[model samples]
Target chain A: MKTRKKVKQITADGFKYAFLTIMLVFAAFPLIQVVINSFKTDADVKTMPIGLPEKWVFNNYRDAWEIGGYARAYFNSFLVGGCTIVIVLTVVGLGAYALSKLHFKMRGFFTAYFFVAISLPGFLYIVPDYFFMNKIGILDTRMSLVIVYTAMQIPFNMLLLRTFLGGIPRELEEAAKIDGCNELNSLLKITVPIAKPIFLTVALLVFVNVWNEYLWSNTFIITDELKTVATRFVKFTGEYSSNMARIYTASVISILPVVLLYFIFSNKFIEGMTSGSVKG
Target chain B: MNNNLGQTALFAIMRNKKVINNMKKTSIIPYLFILPAFIIHFCIVTLPSLSTLAMSLFEWNGIGNATFIGFGNFTEIFTEDNVVKIAIINNLKWLAIFITVPIIMGFIVAIIVSRIIKGQMFFRVVYFIPYVISAAVAGKIFTAYMNPYYGINVFLDKIGLTSLGDTLWLGNPKIALYSVAFVDNWHWWGFVMVLFLGALQQVDPVLYEAARVDGANRIRELLHVSIPGIKPTIAFVLIMTVMWSFLTFDYVYVMTNGGPANSTEILATWIYKNAFAKYRAGYANALCVLQSGICLVFYFVQRYISKKGGMEDED
Candidate 1:
């Protein structure tokens, strides 16, 4: 009986491994195929989809880079994304800190205000937001993108930071106060440093959100040069008749930074996100 | 002696005044820190969004004089628009898929990743890399890969499954929607996997240890230990995925642009086309209002279920 059971368990384990292998293949196949196709020339791209290129063509990368003007687009994305993160983090962090730490008169109302904002779908604001931005004479600039993104991101950012800050014991701040630090000093010196992990997570989340942003960028930004990398997809490949190899290569390059960042900071990224998720 | 005593009293009073000042200074700092965020939120999200609500009441081309058309757009959304009905059904499809596929797959993949004695990090990273790519980029890659003539279709044909190749995946209105969904699942599962993996860690190792001691096998252990351990995470994921599905515009817009005769239209993309593309801003805002209502329903449903579940667990 024991021997028979052992055989059954072994067979089951083998089946389990096989199932896992198939699933992983299913999950990863398209991405791997795309990465491989990025190296193919035009003829090879069309002729050989599943297989490797006949000749390894690096010129696709060069053409994709120059023709797409990805360098400038990347810089524009960086400027907008970076400024958005800075502005959002500072604002949300402070707001969250105030909500969590302070005993202000309107604390309950303010916190509830943010929670309500967090629940609304962003697209509901698209049309009116566009009109508002246009009215303000900032419609085609990178600043418009930054301001818009920062606003949309603030409620969630505030809530996440608030949760993280709430986890920190108030004793740390009390100790800082005893040492000659004022409230501002304590927040800057004590709270910020200790919450470094959460800070990094928020910053990275902000970076990815803004970097991958499309709807707002596509809506508010009309100028060709002002388009961020995300909007470039709609502009460059809008009609869906662009050259296959070049478009694929451009798409791959444009998403490279975000992929690289995920590889680097995924641990904190996962943790911070899960914290908010689990609690919710 | 009298003069020296007077100097000490004045010094003490000044020191007390400085302490009070410092206390006042500290109290204002958090607000100062939060002011920028509030200002931006008010300017960007709150103000524009309120105006959107107001605009839904008026009929005006973006370039024209505003005319009040109270509830006219809203009335049209529910009464005459067939596209709204199609979008609502498609939105249902998205909600169903988003709720099921990610949770089920994420659960299974999380289990596999957790059971891996080696390459856990590698598998995790590999699976998650796709989620970071902009939806546009992913859509382009899929567009090529799914091309009928020269892409996966040809490969399928060479392997004797020619029918799979020749089918116009995106060209057919019937299957184009599912094709878009396939692309979305590819991009989204990794993020779900990561979330599940984190929840998996929170599952105590001792439960598995106990199952093993009882001579339970891998499947039994997973069924008995893993599923129950991450139930909360599963519930949370279900709710979030539903919300995300309803709000999905990026993948659909980028991949199909509601193409092949609007077969792949979801609420967001439909709203975009109606508002901006067709120049029906009022009608689109009405659609937007309807979408928000849909989101609210799901939000409340999740909240109710979770609350009920929490009560049952307590008993």
Candidate 2:
């Protein structure tokens, strides 16, 4: 009976491994395909799409960098994403601190307001917002994307930060107050230090969102110099439709920053993303 | 005695004034902290959203003079616009697909991974890789893989799957929406699995032990113990799935541009075309409101169902 049970357990283990391996392949195959195709020449890609290239060429990257204007796109994405992150961190950090700690009459109202704001579809206001931006003369500029991204991401970041802040001991802030530190000083000196993990999480989330944002970036920033990696990709693909290697290289170039960052900080990325859904 | 009473009144008045001043200072701090977020949000989201509502009642190109034509946009959208109808249907199709496919796939994967003793984290990170990649990148990757001449089609053809290989996945209108949705789901379900896994970790282990003691097989344990344990998470995921379905624009737009005769036109993309490409700003605003209205309906419905479910659980 013992031997029989052992055999059954072995079979179960085998099945489990098989299932997981299949799922892993399913998950990783497309990305692997992208990476592989990025290295192949156009003829190699056409003939053997899913196989190792006979002659691995590196010119695609150079071509994509120069012809596709990916370097400029990358800089634009960083500038927009970086500025948006700074604004989001400041606004959301302060707002979250107040919402989590301070006693105020409109706290409940603002909390619900953000909840609704997060759910409100962006399509609802894109047209009017576009016109508004055009009238304000910020259209075709990176600042326009930064402003919109900051507003769009605030609610989620605020709520997440609030949750994190709520978990921090109240004594820390109260003790700082007793030490004669003002509210802003207490937050900057005391709360910000302790909330570093959450701040990192929020910053990463904002960076990813702004970097990967396509629709608003596509609509608002029409200038080639101002286009982000995502919008630039659309134009790049159109320009390089027949050259599969160049297209793939540009695709890889566009995604490299995000993908690299994600791999390095996968744990924090997962935690930040799942925290709101699981806990809220 | 009168002097003493007057002095006591003066002290009381001074204390009250001081208390009022302290209250004002305390109240202002929170407002000050919250003001920056509120200002940006109002300017970008709230004000523009209000204008969208107002604009829907007028017939105007975005640049030119405006004329009020009350309910005209709505009337035209419901009756005249064939694309709106297709978009609504396509969105509904997307809703149906998302509600079932990802939830089930994510749940099953979570369960399988949860039972494993090692490398669960590896599986999780791998699965979530797609979710991190931009939708545009995901779209481009699939567009390449779905290319008729040099992609999965050729492989399928080699395997004697002639019909499958012949499919113009994105070019053909009949299956274009589904193809885009498949790519979206490929990037989506792993995130779902991770979330469910997180919820699964919080489930009480004793219940699973009890099920095992009661001679419950794996399937039975899953049905009775695991399902009930993660009910709330499942419900939340479902609600979000519906909400996101209506808002899904990136994959469809990036892949097809609602093309091949508008077969893949979800509401968001349709709204984009109407507003930007066609310059039917007023009509597009109506569609936007309609999309939001559908989302609100989904939100309330989920709230009602979850409330009912909560009460049932109490019983």
* TM-score leader: 2
lDDT of 1 by residue, A80-100 (tens): 988987887777777887887
Chain B TM-score against the true chain B, each candidate: 0.87, 0.89
Model 2 DockQ class: medium
DockQ (model 2, Cα): 0.63
lDDT of 1 at A63: 83
lDDT of 1 at A43: 76
Q: Per-residue error at B20 for model 1, in Å? A: 11
**Model 2 lDDT at residue B74:** 93
Worst 10 residues of 1 chain B by lDDT: B306-315
Off by over 4 Å in 1: A1-17, A239-242, A277-280, B1-27, B209-224, B306-315
lDDT of 1 by residue, B104-128 (tens): 8888888877876667787777777
**Would you list the C-alpha lDDT of every candidate in the order shown?**
0.78, 0.87
Q: Please, what are the lDDT tens digits per residue for candidate 2 over residues A1-280?
A: 9999999998998899899899899899888888888899998887767768898888888988999888888899999999999999999999999999887899999998888787777888899999888887888988889899999998888999998899999768767866888889989999999999889988998898888888899999888988999999988887778888888888889889988999999999999887655211
Q: What is the lDDT of candidate 2?
A: 0.87
